[model samples]
Target: MAPGEPAEPETAVVIATSGSTGAPKGVLLSARALTASAEATHARLGGPGQWLLATPAHYIGGLQVLVRSMLAGTTPVFLTGTGFRPDDFAAAAAQLTGGPRYTALVPTQLVRLLDDGGAGLAAARTFDAIVLGAAATTPALRERAAEAGVRIVPAYGMSETASGCVYDGVPLDGVHVDLADGRIRIAGAVLAHGYRLRPDLTADAFADGWFTTSDRGIRHDDGRIEVLGRADDMINTGGVKVSANAIERVLCAQPGVRDACVVGVADPEWGEAVVALVVPAGEPGDLRAAVRAELGPASTPKRIEFGAELPLRGPGKIDRAAVKTRLQPGSHG
Candidate 1:
């Protein structure tokens, strides 16, 4: 929005989602939803302090940084330099001269900082909380951050819910997370008004104050929610169901593997074969064996390809469609 030109009175922010799976969407967030999200976050984080905006301002996670800062009456620190540079992040960190410093980052950015082993690493450890979202944070990443003593809170939410409503598997204050037939649904003061001009999509997604998410999850007995993966991401092979995200996590946990993206490919016999693209593709046979041992034979990838890095869509989401095309028959992967 242009400076001094206020947003519609009913809408505080209209975040445009990339909507990689379909057409893009403009999520209209009311001042109430935005404020509730920011306030609930502070309550969960033991009260707000300073927040650094590391991701792009266009994305929901980054937009909330500004919202949270406004609600707290504090100036948020922005990352310096073009793109995300560890050195630049560290330099920005040095500028926050306050207590209980906080920031949000994607898993890729967090991985870079932990690997920096310099000022960036030192700077990251000082934050009271670091909200990690915008992609599935693998167990390996969590382990790395924990070993370094950095407080990492894995958040689960989207633009439809006004940002991260579930932090570390627990819903924020006044927010409710549930599962209907295995699909995750959220209802709270944090929900966006609806898509700016797409009522059909809005009606299908939101109802009775609940915003249904594409991702499927398990509500643990302890009142914690465990997102299994996207509902459609379950791969059916040889009559057995398997989670591609499961394989990805297991692959990333292996030695010499930096990242992993698994997808189902067409196979005459199995219908949809499990295929994986790994970063640094270390010992494909051994990696396959490890996966077989962890998740069983049917879950093993029919093929594995190595890459320097994974393609991204919005924030740090792996470009699934791009990965599928590259790994498809006859195309260069």
Candidate 2:
């Protein structure tokens, strides 16, 4: 089926995972599941309103914007182009004429918009709320957006959940969140039917009514979930277990650094060495010191590489597996 095409019979939509860490899987979502997710999102955001499609339509984040608009009986304004620009986003925001306006974006796009100065700040302030997802967002970035008057809601979910079932660490109405063995599990009306043509994978991911995620997280006393990095994405260097997401967060807090991705590379002595890839080539500038201050010396990256931009899969998510491949021994960009 082509992009944005409705799924067959009971299936409402089919979305493919970005496969940043492994093989991509096609998640099958039913009409009931999609509607449940969209409705819950609208209700959470103070009822339905016009939506701006700023991300790619093929991805769940962007596709949900269109789905929400359809359910709201509103036409979503699409930001057309191969690239996302502050000017384009400003124009799209200007086109919204009805009730409370909203849009979905990844952290990278949010960073770009925040960097665009007056035009970006003005456009960002127009949204009733912005759903930021696809990956973990740093607290530093969130603070910057908030300071600039952008109300960003950090969302967490995957294709199997039909989109973001958790907003700002809280499960949406009708969505149940639990942690088992340090892994995150979700169950709700928004749960997808299963993976398309992959029964084995489906059974492995979803069982006993809960879709098990690859992420590790902690449940707060206040009934909120704080997601750590992926379980598989954890780095073991010199017998020390370190969270790659934590290191990336520290690096992102530094000035001149737009984004950062941390991964464990093969190392004989240390078992696996922690490495960092930063965007826009910031001066390394005490990254080790910062990480040491936040975590410890063991969590510091063994090496830091700079690039014009980090590799992305779709919808502005950092492709860590691709970055690892490019940074492998004897490999070239």
Candidate 3:
């Protein structure tokens, strides 16, 4: 499709998946589906007012901000830049002129804003609600943002769902969430029609009125869903299973660690070894002890590597594949 070209008939929007895990697929969403999602979000959010666009326009989260703004009969304030800075976000957020102000952001952007700690913190407090998505938000980050007077709604969904159908582990109106074989499955009016020009892929992902996600999750007794991690992200070491995300959460909460990415590397002894890439270059500080305390010795990372920063792909998600490649023996010169 050419730039600025209109979408195909009956298609409200065409969004490309981040392809962080695999090849990117073009998701075809209809007008009804998008409107349903927007309406449900507004109902849950106490009705939409003004939106601040801090994320890139190409991604689903950013695009939904625009869609909701249009539906609410309001103009969204755009933060113009290739990089996200606290000052820029503050300036843009100051432009919101009414009550019930809203915006969407990924977890990484929230961390950066918290780190800035001046005008950025003040600006973040102005939003009535900020939808955090595209990646999981660490519990430590959430606590910090709350202490700063930020109302964060951690969202979960993909491009295939038109946007977020679940907010803070609760399914929005008209959305149904279930666990099938430990994988999160969604069925609702917000689902996309199918992937554009990829019938086989669509057939595999969506069936029986439920869209099967690659993420593994468990529904709590209180009716809240807890997403564990991607099913494919599980590591097997000495025949024991470990969740990369589970280890990462513990590492990120520790002192002196800015961020962390965990991956499984080939090891002749263990079959696969759990490895960690930590950011900001500091002493790891008993990470093995920490992991063993929480998840036992089998799940502890075998090696810890320090780096200035973890490589990110789209929308601030840690690029695990890139990190694994860089950690290989002969990959570094």
Candidate 4:
């Protein structure tokens, strides 16, 4: 079911997470929880600013935009069926002459706007705030957007917490953030009741009145939380658990690598070996030296594949399954 659609009073709906690691779990969000989440998000985002609908409405990001607009008493400008060019977005965003204009964009959309250049960057600079969600916002992207004078807030949350309960890695107003055993724990009005049809998962996930996130994180000394990566994505090679997202972060920092996805390949001895799928900006070879210099040998990918772009799901996150499929025969088996 598409996000923001009027769900049955207490009926179950399936919502897919990014599914970068394993299978996508069909999360059942009730209408009540959905309503509560939308209302809470609207309240936190300063009461339903004008929304530019870029991401697919089937995803939570798109669904929340519609719900937030409804709560704010405004209609979101649909970018779908209108084309996805930066100029198209600029024209639409420019035409928004209503209450505080805001838009939710994934990192790729934001980057595309910047790359489209000309009026595109200028257009993006004019939002009340441009929220970056679904994936980690690189320092480079953040710096560029900030330089362009955009209020670029890096958001944190997932399908469970109703999109994002944290902005700039900090918990939203009225939301409680805690770290237990390096996992992110959240509790507040914004939190969903529980996942439907998965009572065992609900019990295991929500503990002590707080929903425990799959992300491994730590509360900073300054009170902000940094999500390290998904607990399941960790690869234990020779008794060492290496974070795939952590490795991707380092690899993505190199020039010519527009994107990076690190995964663990089964090995007879080490149990798992790290392999990287890179979307090259220029030359794939240049990234190898950069990885060696920056991430060191252990973290350096045993194999690197350059391609047009990484396979992405609804929100432009790397599709790890597709990446694994690209490996040499018998590499993963």
Candidate 5:
């Protein structure tokens, strides 16, 4: 784990994909795949110079920050703090004195930074690139980041792909990313070998050297991947397929809708109807009307439930399954 240690060529590294779906899985990554992905990122971003590490070393994204720094022959600046905050991250970046400094963060952190405004937002704008991962980025956040003069790159990758192979809405170099049967499949040297000790799960997840992710995606003509939430998160209502993530994205775009989640509830008529559990901004009912107006009838939720806040894991990812359990028949509202 030291700099230039040359340990086993790193065929795979385990990263805990957030348990937003059900259970988190430790994804194995390869050295070649990781390197290829890094190279691709550098090629597009004008090569790696110096990096600022704000994430935990245990996470794949955090580990890749170290890898990139070592590969560039530079030591990265670390964020020595209790937990993630805009002030701490900005202070860490301010300490760096060399080339362009880059850091990775989850969407929740980005929201906090945007909300902080003054020094935090100013510091956030100073970075060469602010990479976002772990969960989907809201359209509102993306716009806010741009207006703040910060260059933002939204990433889509798991531990199996060696952290991330897509940057700024574009796929990394030499990585073959595609969608098969609604599942996101990645093929390349960066693909993981298999799961640690679950052969059955591994067999179901991997095929012919390509790692199949549980998340659904669509590769647009521009070669950008549009992730459509997890496959298991889909809700089938009266023969109509509704994507919780897709609807959530639209709902989150509405004003006063702080956080949004779409879930399937058993219904005698439709079998299952799409219901929304939202974290509203002081006015839940008004936000619900806005969401309805935005997505229209089909995508609109049959009912909107309010929560003070959405459940979160690690950094800023919503624990969808946990939220589902909270919304269970007898659970607290």
Candidate 6:
């Protein structure tokens, strides 16, 4: 497709999702859907104003910032000159010329912002809402941000929805969120047409006006949804199925732990073994007892590896395949 040339009748833009591995899928988004998403965000956030584009534009989260800004009739300030850091963020934020400032970020970037003590936290508080997308955030991170007087709105969506169609576990106006066979499903004006060049994959994912997500979730009686980890990520050991997300929450809550990734490793006797790779804050302590006490011995990690940083792929998501390889027997990574 050349510049100024017409895209497919159904699609205005094709945003490729960042997969952990293998070929990335290009999501065919319609102009109507993208604009609807931006409009819905403004409705939920009171009103859109100036936006800060801290993330790369290629990602949906970043792309939505531009859309929201355009819809708001505001010029967005871009973060440049270096990687995501507190001073740079504050400096860029200071350049915003519109009212009710906003920005979108992955949880990892938010963590880095909070790490600078109060400078970044103070800068983040200036925004009317800070949309956290790309991955699920820990309760601890949210509490810390709240304590610092920063507003963090957790968003759930993907390229297929144009951006985040759910905010703080509640579906945005005109959007529908439900569970099908323990997996999350979404339907709304914000939904994309389908995946480009993959009719079979598109057909399998979207049906009956709902796009079935790979993630497992629980829909609250009040219409809120709680996203568990991916369905395939559940660890089964000795006939017991354990939620890796649950264990990760426990591990992250433990003292001296910063971030954690839990994976299932192939085992001879147990079929699969639970393992963890954790980033320690300072002097690490024994984490086994905490997991054992909270989730029982079956869910407890068979082996725990502490690292300085986690291997990440596709918008700050934990590289699980890499983590699994690092925890595999006799593998030194």
- lDDT at 145, model 2: 88
Clashes of each: 0, 0, 0, 1, 4, 0
Query: What would the per-residue lDDT of candidate 4 be over residues 58-88, giving only the tens digit for each residue?
Result: 7888888887888778878877445367887
Model 4: clashing residue pairs?
256-281
lDDT of candidate 6 vs native? 0.88
- lDDT of every predicted structure (CA atoms): 0.87, 0.86, 0.87, 0.75, 0.76, 0.88
- Candidate 2 lDDT (Cα, 0 to 1): 0.86
Model 6 clash number? 0
Model 5 compared with the native: what TM-score?
0.89
Q: Give the TM-score of each candidate.
A: 0.94, 0.94, 0.95, 0.87, 0.89, 0.95
Count clashing pairs, candidate 5.
Answer: 4
Instruction: Return whichever of 1 and 3 wins on lDDT.
Output: 1
Which one wins by TM-score: 3 or 5? 3
Pairwise lDDT winner, candidates 4 and 5: 5
- Report the lDDT tens digits of candidate 1 across residue range 221-327: 89999898888788899889999988988888898888999998887899888999898635544789999999999999999989888988898888888888888
The parts of candidate 6 lying over 4 Å away from their true place are 1-7
| Tens-digit per-residue lDDT, 1-333, candidate 5 | 222543233545666666666666766667776677677766767778788888777877888888888787887998887867778877888887767677888887787788788676888887788789877888877888888787889988877777777775577777787778978888876677766555687899788877888788877878778888888887888887777887898778777777788888777887787777887765544555665677565566777788887888765678777777777656775
Q: Candidate 3, which segments miss by more than 4 Å at Cα?
A: 1-9, 280-284
| lDDT string, candidate 3, 186-250, tens digits | 99999987887777988999998899999999999999998989999998999998989899988
Reference-based TM-score, model 6: 0.95
* Candidate 2 lDDT tens digits, 249-325: 88988877778899888888999989988884346577778898889988998888888888888667788888998
lDDT of 3: 0.87
